[model samples]
Target: MVKLDGISSFVAIAEAGSISAAARRLHLSKSVVSERLAELEQHLGAPLFHRTTRKLSLTEDGSAFLERANRIVWEVQDAVAEVAERRGSLSGPMRLSAPVTFGRMHLGPALYPFLARHPGISLTLELDDRRIDAAAEGYDAVIRHGTVEDSRLVALPLAPSRRLLVAAPDYLARHGRPDSLAALRQHRAIYYTNRNVADWRFADVRQDVFVRPPAALRVNNGDMMRDAALAGLGLALLPSFIVGEELRAGKLVRLDIGHEAAQELIYVAHPEGRRASHKLRTLVSTLREHFGTPPYWDVV
Candidate 1:
């Protein structure tokens, strides 16, 4: 029989990405964690992770083991929770991944109260602009912007978020706003580098199409673009959620052409066909209820 305690250590390492991180999460010493992983590999006669100077990544074997290990860990947790809930307690760790700006400006602030409500539930939230492989990375949930691309995940729309093209009031006052997509060609623009800077899409009642705008500056950070636009650098096409405050506060002005602005739906996503836990279900439902009908952005 495989030692379940040793399996827990492996799963922790895989989820945390390093021995030190896993050790910290599990409240174990690094040397002990390392030794346990070595023992597991020795017992299985196969390596689970490829170790390097900085971090660890799962080998093909490790990937397979992680999938099984995640199941085992969850099963054990569920079993314990089921027995404990008779005494009235809901508790476990939840790992979440999200885009940096959205997490920082939106979800981070929103989650504080949720955390306060459920003090027993531990949460590890990672914020990054790059997309993460949630299942492979062992993330419990992911909050993302834009249309859902991967159908393998169960995507639940939490709020109505949109993107808009805007420039500072000063920039608009100086250069004047473009009245058509054709007019945008001559204007300098700021863009999120991770997105296709050269090709942009616009849609409205009159026109729905893509435009290739000339890019003057490309940056991956929304905060940077916000700053650049505020400094009178160029027109920026940004997510409405990030710029909603500035737009409402008169620092930025929306450039509305006839039927050119488009809106995107945001979602909380997880792997499809899996039995989502009450914790995930609760958060998803709470967000949906909190932001229904144009979300908090429309409030101001």
Candidate 2:
């Protein structure tokens, strides 16, 4: 019979991305974890992960095994919980992924209180701008900011990620405020390097508004882009989550050509057709509650 401990170690390593990290999560020594993984791989007759000095990634077979592994782990945990007379407190490790800025500014702070409420739940959060393969990476949930086309996952919309075209007061003073698309092009731009900077779209009411300014600065981080814009660098088309305070305060001015920019729906996604554990369900519920309707970020 396959050992459950080995499977648990495998899942931990996949999620944590390193032997040492996984060992820390399992509260086991590195050698013991390594032995468990070696035994598990030997039984399966294939290498589950590709290991380098600095990083570890799943092999193709490992990717296929991960989803089933998750199901097995959660099912066993649920079975025990049922036998335990449905204990009042829920406890398990939840792995989550999100964009850096959103996680730092919103998700992390909001979820910490949930952790306090349920002291038994353990959370490992990965914050990156790059899109992740949640199942392959062993994350219980992933927060995404745009269209989630992967049919393998169930996506629950969190909120409307509304955007705005804004510039610093000094920048507007020097370059003159743009009242229309043509005038908007006259100013330079601060670009977000990850997405397509050239093809910007707006809402229906703001159809007359368009921008393709020459890029003066390019950065992948929202915080850096916001800081650059605040330094009187150039106009920036930024999400309200990142610049909402600046727009509300006197730090920045929104160039309302006609209406707001296009709003992409943000979503929380997890593997489809799988039963979520009580711990995962709690996190999802907490997130939905925290980011509903107008969304907390847009409040101020």
Candidate 3:
């Protein structure tokens, strides 16, 4: 019979991408983890990973093994959680990924009360603007803005947010407000370099669209874009969630360009067709409840 312990160790190593890291996480010695992995390979009669001095990469067989291993591990964990819940408690670590500013400003605040409500649940939240592969990264779920592109993932719409073109009061006073998209060419623009730095998509309708003019100051960080706009560096296109207070306080003015700069649809997404974990489902449902009546950005 395949030993569940050895299989669990192998899965840990595969997910961690390094034996040492897996060992650290599992609180097991590196040698023990390595030995179990070797035993697992022997039982399967195939190499699962490409071991190197720096990193371990899954072989094709390992990748296939990982998919099943993830399910098995979750299933075992679910059984434990089921028993725990019967005792009226939910307990586990949840890994979540989200965009930097939005997570910090909007989602983080909403999650605080939820976390407080569930003392048994621990969270590892990674804040980043870069698109992440949740499955590869082993995230329980990701809080995302913008339309879903990958059909492989299951997406639940958590909220509606919009991207708006705006300029600081000072900037608009100096450079003058852009009357149309064509006038954007005459103004200096602060850009999020990591995002669509050169070409910004805007539309009057779903079918009618065009790209905006290029930017002069290209930055990678969304917060930096907000800072630059606040400092009167240039006009910026930002999600309303990040600049809602600024706009409300009259620090920034929404540009009346008479077009929607594409919608930013917020979603809680995870791997498709996977059995929903109790903790993950609870968290997602909580968010859906918080965002059900359209986010504060819409009203503000």
Q: Pick by TM-score: which candidate is best?
A: 3
On lDDT, the leading prediction is 2
lDDT of 3 by residue, 9-101 (tens): 987887677888889767799999999999989999999999878888999999898778877887898897788788888788888999888
Task: Name the regions of candidate 2 deviating beyond 4 angstroms.
Answer: 11-27, 41-70, 80-85, 197-199, 204-211
- Model 2 residue 37 lDDT score: 94
What local lDDT does model 1 show for residue 20? 91
lDDT of 1 by residue, 17-116 (tens): 8989889878899999998999999999999999889889999999888788878887887677566566576578888888888888878767888788
Please, what is the whole-model Cα lDDT of each candidate in the order they appear? 0.79, 0.82, 0.81
Provide the lDDT at 136 for model 3.
61
Ranking by lDDT: 2, 3, 1
Name the runs in model 1 displaced over 4 angstroms.
13-27, 45-66, 81-87, 197-199, 204-209
Winner on TM-score between 1 and 2 is 1
Question: How many steric overlaps are in each model, in order?
Answer: 1, 0, 1
Candidate 1 vs. true structure, TM-score: 0.84
Worst 10 residues of 2 by lDDT: 202-211
List of clashing residue pairs for candidate 2: none
Better of 1 and 3 by TM-score: 3
RMSD score of candidate 1 (Å): 3.3
Per-candidate RMSD, Å: 3.3, 3.8, 2.6
